[model samples]
Target chain A: MDDEQQEKQHLANDGRQMTLIDQIIRNKVFNCRYWKEDCFGLTAVTLVDKACKLDCVGATYSGTGKPVPFLCLLMKLLQINPDKEIIIEFLKSKDYKYISALAMFYIRLTSKPKEAYPTIEQFYADFRKIRIRNLDGTFAIWHMDELAEKLLSEEIIFGISLPRFQKRWILEELGQLEPRKSVLEEELQNQEQEQVQVAEQQNQEKDQEQGQEQ
Target chain B: SDDGKQKLNDEDTLDETEYALWKIRELKRIKQFNDEKNKYEIEKAEIDRRRNLTDMQRIQEDFKLGSDKTKMEDKTKYV
Candidate 1:
């Protein structure tokens, strides 16, 4: 067969091995953390499983402690509601900048070409002004306009080559977006149709008044 | 009233010293835990990196060896 076919087979094998390793890692992580006093009572078994499968063994935690709960929370949100309305609402939140950043990043990953803009544009002004604690426990403010600009300008936002293998670990496991088209044009068309209808109704009323008066 | 004030002041001093001791112990325990955590993390990373390298090497070797690769044996084995 061709080199392309060989390459495709190689990739499939690579994916299969990766998942196998992922399952084993998940098993070890659960076995280790599940019995810890702090983690013993935690609920949401499915979310915890998803969180464990995330490759964070070597991740640098903040000064406070372990990695940010970004992955776990994102998993929980996706598991509970794939509609992403709750996550979108998180963007409007002024209280938690880190959570907002997670939401913004999620949008970057999930949004369709045109549907991205309006969903993200309003949050732009807010998040740029927001500050978040990094994984290293350092306080940092988001250059939100820079981030927005990056998302809008780039095609492959999460697939940057520098952090090669671990980029997948950093990003939330992608959840499907509900099918949506930009409704701006449709809304405008609807308004125009309503205006025409209102005009026709007004003319009819005027004609009736004239007939009655006559 | 003067005697009562003196007792209250003594109690305050004892409480302050006790709280200071608690803080010191707490800080020490936290530092030890973090040190242990960091050491465990380093160990885990080393183990993972080695495993990852082996996995990559094995995959590359398998690809290089090719699907048709098989052991040579006695002449009549396939027949």
Candidate 2:
């Protein structure tokens, strides 16, 4: 065999050795009481299991669906833990678009319909503002980042901690739509006022009956 | 004969009242069910719409990136 061919074979063997070393290190790092094997990886499995435990502990006093949002929020919050290198490694393998979509789904799913729906619209609007370089040498708009950031941030409904850039983007998006938010608040206030009026009328009738009896 | 006729008329009135009440309750139950079904249908449609939009967006991006290569080659040849 040629000298070059022998060298190549030796390099390939070294590469295989390094891979084995990496696997051994990973196994040692993850084979702990807190770390559990999951579909995605050890860290994701551990986080989900921990979240499920928290869910069970809190479920005794509340209804089922109500705790889902909080659990989801907690999962996102857990991602921000400084020791989550494994989780971060798994997330890095995901495409940005896919990651953003999943984040948006999580955010929306965990949020209240009344609050989350408007935020969803806002996310779409922000997505419309993303400029991409089109093939025709023209700029086109995309909203994937904006949507992702909005989902990541804790500002809209569930106060979940996201990465810094995502939080900033969400804040900027929310700032742009402050007027619409105020209008929604005003409408909610008006509805509450009407409810109070109806309740007062019923109370007044009861008071009048008691006065007549006396 | 007059007393029997009156008794028959009273019995018919009672039957009509019972039938009307039962019909009203049935209609209400049907309406409630329809409302709940419509809500689920609306939610399903919204989810479908979002999925379609996402798919179209991805396709549009792929088309833009893919077709641009041919256009670039054409420009290079013309130049």
What C-alpha lDDT do the candidate models reach, one value each? 0.43, 0.38
Model 2 bad stretches (over 4 Å): A1-183, B1-79
User: What fraction of the genuine interface contacts, i.e. the true contacts, does candidate 2 reproduce?
Assistant: 0.00
Candidate 2 residues A80-162, lDDT tens each?
A: 32233443343343223233233344435434444444444433322212222222223333344344434543443222232
Candidate 2: residue A102 Cα off by (Å): 16
- Tens digit of per-residue lDDT, candidate 1, span A164-195: 12121112223323322322437557989999
- On a 0 to 1 TM-score scale, where does candidate 1 land against the true structure? 0.31
Best-fitting candidate, measured by TM-score? 1
> At residue B54, what lDDT does model 2 achieve?
72
lDDT of 1 at A158: 25
* Chain B TM-score against the true chain B, candidate 1: 0.50
Question: Which DockQ value does candidate 1 get?
Answer: 0.01
